[model samples]
Target: MAYRDQWKMLHLLNTSMRGALKETELIEMGIDCYPDTIQYLKDDGIVEMDGTGVYSLNPMVRRMLNKFMIAMGAGDMKEIYVDVPSCFIVMPFSEEWSDTVFYDFIQPAVIKSKMECVRGDMIPRVGKLSENIVKQIQRTGLVIADISVPNANVFYELGIADAIGRDVFLLYEKNIEQNLPADIQGAHYYAYDRNNIPESVERFAESLIQWKELYRVDVTLKYCRK
Candidate 1:
């Protein structure tokens, strides 16, 4: 099977509710020799099938396809089917500082907003750090960045999130002088301190809910206009 045909098959499976496909269904969609294509996809670890011929996309491949669709501005399809919004945290990876923020503020706040929160350190270090970070960022619906320190890795990840138009929330430790770069100087950020963590968590959750509502409205309007 040609590469394009394989893509079509994968796309169909991806957009389906259960990510399940049958040989007959593929043929009905005008795929020629779909069994061979399915075999090819299986060989590439892109899909898996049962003994009953019900095929489904591999979880990793499905996530990659979702990210691709988002990057391509296919927001309508992606938003409509997304089960849970994910927020990626970009912060300096330090045991003391990162753990305190993650457990005390970030995790609780995001869970309260009913969204999943993931950080770079949570991911398995199986590949290039830069590539892995960007891939995780691409898959998220939003980004929460902590710029309390002048961390290069955090800044780089934040840039990728910004370029992709992901809704972002900046955070900083209170009383620290923030010399934000020109690109993000005008952006609003939440300030927190150890003394006011509970209050900050409440505010952060509220802010995320508001941001998510606004994002949904914006996406809806854009798609309607098109």
Candidate 2:
């Protein structure tokens, strides 16, 4: 109805997304968003409503689209610009304690270092082979994954990420049988002991910091002949 009300609606939608709010789950903060509005936005190509009730961001060439939106004074300036470097995180069981620490503690540490971290639960889709997982893997420039457990999907996705030339930071639980396929043993990796997750995480991060690039340029240069 009113411009202020429309802005409020955008705020609610943005909050739902940014806070990882689900469609059916209402926030205690009181948002009165209706399904129809969400659908309308999707129809307008402003958002993408996929299988299930989850809503996904409708990305645009903001550098170009925003120029038009701004020249016409059509949208909020704040909404036009936000930096969240896409990060793909693959793991085995999501509820594992180490997973939670990565979600709660280690991920924030990575994000604080300036990156947008997305987890399994926060993913818009479910099941092992959903488009959400696939798209995230393709879009992400960085991947921090664990292949300690016997997960076919993890191994499959790891190989795919490698094929796409992603900068993957591999991790596995120490003393545990690596679920990775022997064929892909050439993939780079490191192990961690959950007994000292913090220290192990610190070690992982330190190794990452000391590296010259996300992907090994030197190794690639040397292996070009072979």
Candidate 3:
């Protein structure tokens, strides 16, 4: 762990795609990056300067860091303060179809893509249901919205995800694609058949993998003082 401080900095920077780490902010995290460590990182090409005194992880290096974290196990990263990426599912709950779609299709697909999958109903109630949903949407890196039955709550949740700029993946039953609201008719979606569970899950998983790589989910991690 000769470069443990640098490792910690990269883990934190890789957590978000948003902005760079300013030199002053590094001091707040108790990181010594003024000249020596920052020069070490620049020489290695692991990070790039966004401006005069700000730096962010290089895109390719970020991907490598993600792979390293995965290989080392998410739990191991948590021990070092890295946040795990997660996908939240937005769908109508307590319906017969809900169980089928979540278990048979969505959950498996999310698992295949190496991310945690959670839904509104799955979380323990803390305050209002709407409030919890909003919190989860904001916390998650990606959102998967199922608009198969035109449920009002689902639509509202989907709108929140959109407003907050989370990476969203729309899904629907093939039969209802034509009946979807005109507002979202132009949006891209995956239509699955009820009878084709396994195949649909595979296709959805593959598509999700490709989409994640292209968009690079928005994730954030803050340095916690020990």
Candidate 4:
């Protein structure tokens, strides 16, 4: 298969809204539906079409392609598609806390590590918010979850991130680090001080850089074949 075809197919698969796109939509989006490329994927069962001419990627094939790309040690896969490595923060959101914890603390640290920082509520989607949250969690390279307060929704998001084997970094306020749930007692986490915001963020950025290095090492070691 041509590399351009693969790239075009992958791009279309991700950019399609509502999980499928008609050929006209592809053209409007400036993507050409090369007949040979489409036919190749169709013959291989990698792409599907409906009676009305909407195209969708086969889910299983998409999964296999993603895993193969990852296993080939294409860290972040930027060459194949335009994407900035992003970190999805699973945390309790409130007006004050969003500013204090996320905007001030986590966002700077994530930016310092050269990644986009996003939260579940920050993403815009036209579906159930929960489904959007799951999709964001799946797309991100790292998950930073603030378990400072025992909110059920925070823990629920954390569970979803954990269940899907995301690289999670937990954070909590200074004194409550020891009070985390038993299930995540052994997980990686950091404690931050609210009063010492600047210093705390500096320390968090340092840790985040180290975490990114460790994450890269882990992925390369686990997936890169000798």
TM-scores of the candidates in the order shown: 0.58, 0.48, 0.62, 0.58
Clashes of each: 0, 0, 0, 0
lDDT of 1 by residue, 1-226 (tens): 2654576567567655555867776655545565667678888888898899888889988887676545433233342121126778888878467788888998899888877788777875755666666666655767888888888888888777666445578888887855655568535588888678899899988988886664342232221111
Extract clashing residue pairs from model 4: none
Predicted candidate 3: what Cα RMSD to the true structure?
Answer: 12.1
What candidate 4 gets wrong by more than 4 Å, as runs, is: 1-84, 217-226
| lDDT value, residue 128 of candidate 2 | 41
Off by over 4 Å in 3: 1-53, 56-84, 217-226
Candidate 2's C-alpha runs over 4 A off are 1-85, 126-129, 177-180, 211-226
Candidate 3 on 150-176: residue-level lDDT in tens?
A: 788888888776654456778889987
Output the number of the TM-score-best candidate.
3
After superposition of all CA atoms, the RMSD between model 1 and the true structure is 12.5
